[model samples]
Target: MLIQLAIIGLLFAVFPLALVLISKEQNKFRKLIAVTLFLTFDLIIFGAFTRLTDSGLGCPDWPGCYGEANPFQAHSEIKAAETLLPTGPVTVAKAWIEMIHRYLAMSVGVLIILQMGIAWWKRKSMRHSPWLPTILFVLVGIQGAFGKWTVTMKLQPIIVTIHLMLALTILGMLVWAWQREATQLVLKLPPLLPRLLPFAFVILVLQIALGGWVSTNYAALACHDYPLCNGEVVPQLDFEHAYTLWRELGRTGSGDFLPFSALITIHWVHRSFAWVVFALLASVAWLSRQQAETKQLGNAIFAVLLMQFMTGVATIYFSWPLAIAVLHNAGAALLVLILSVLNYRVRSSAVPVS
Candidate 1:
């Protein structure tokens, strides 16, 4: 089964590998990095879709569906499972979603391998260290491990949240690499701007973690109202259980049914934190506009910030439409990308290409 899975992964990965190998672009390395970055972005979105559709356990297995490489081969088993439990996790539609997500993940892994290979192959000619690709290679391996844990562990909130966090981290690392390869002169910013950006980045990271908590815990509609939670400005909440890090998906650490109050706590924290993140990011965007090189990025930050706020409220007001919820997740990722790129550009020294 594992060997067959390996072959399937290779087949999926081959298309991107061939594109990179046959490309006529002047800078093959940069082109490959860009393609990998784009694919990773798509993977993150698709992952959100998989989660939103409750397909995380579609196959109820890791790396393969019912011990088969593809859903088609496992259709009989899947149909039997769905027949026994019509509303359970292993429907034919969901099996396909889960398998497709795994295949894409495997393909991204192959691209990272190609990146590391090429980085080492041309190490001496390159201005950047090859270790960047080497590290990404390692991170992708760790991510694959978590993907398995997410399934085997039955989608525990902590594990799923960590998996999501790591994906964003991987995306940030890729953006950093892309900026390094496509170096352009960026104007110096005020000293305070440098310091403030990192602070804002930290805040954003925390907010994203909180957002993940809400999603993984199924707390999106806990409040289902704007400017208030459950129609109360200070809704009753169970913080002890709600914030417990190591518990099952819908149970407290003590194995009790997770209370509605706990879900309220989860939702409340995320919504409240958004205000702080939005304000700090707005300040950063405003300050960034003072410098010519960073002006466009500043605008991007503000635009994304607005989108996040609107979509966030829309999700609550509109009762969690799938598209808006997914976009909210994507907005968080775009926020990470823009901030990481801006930070990298600010710190990097641009040299004339002689």
Candidate 2:
């Protein structure tokens, strides 16, 4: 099964590998990094889809479906499970979804391994250090461990949330590494902009964490109203249970069924903190737009911010439709990607150009 899975991963990576090899660009290594980053972005999006559809346990195992390399081989087992619980998490369709997500993740791991190999081989001539890819390799390994725990632990809320956050962290790191390979831009901006960009990045990370908490806990509809949760300025909440972090999916620390008030707490905190994220990020975007070098990226940040806000509200108003919720997750990843680029540029500007 492991060999078959390895072969499948190689097959999935072939197209991107071939693209890098055949590209006319002088730096094939850099091209590979960009392609890996693009696929990582897709992986994060598809990961969201898998989670939103409740397919995380479709295979009921790690790295394969029912000890097989792909869902087709596990059809009988999946069918049996589905027959037993027709609306359960182990349906044939969900098995496929979950396995495909695993396949994509493995392919990304394969690509990163290739990146590390190439970086080491070309270390002398390469402009960027190889250590970043090495670190990314280690991070992907840890992420894969979390992926296993996500299933083995029965979609434990905290474990799942950390998995989501780790994926985004890898994405952000790739963005930073990729940007470092690009032509350096030195912008003479107001002193505050450089300081603000990193601060904004930190704020965004916290908001994403809170957002992950909301999703993993299935609290999207806890309020069922916009701007005002449950039709009140401040709904009754149980933060003690909501933020416990070490419990099961829908149970409190004491193993009782989690209360509606706890879900309300999770949803409300995420929704409320979003305004702070928006204000800070939007201000950074507005300030960035004033600079000639960063204007386009600033515009993109502003646009995604609006899209994120709309989709976030729509998810509540529309009762968390799968597509919109997945898009909301994608938007968050996109924001991370964009902010990574902006932060890299802003920080790079500080280096005294020789």
Those runs of model 1 whose alpha carbons end farther than 4 Å from true positions after fitting are 18-24, 350-354
Whole-model Cα lDDT per candidate?
A: 0.90, 0.92
Please report the candidate that would top TM-score against the real structure.
Answer: 2
Quality of model 2 by C-alpha lDDT? 0.92
Candidate 2's residue-wise lDDT over 33-92, tens digit each?
899999999999999999999999999998888898998888999999999999979998
Candidate 1 lDDT tens digits, 181-258? 884784667666777888999999999999999999999999988898888998997899899999999999999899
The estimated TM-scores of all candidates read 0.96, 0.98
Candidate 2 worst ten-residue window by lDDT: 345-354
Which residue pairs collide in model 2, if any?
Answer: none
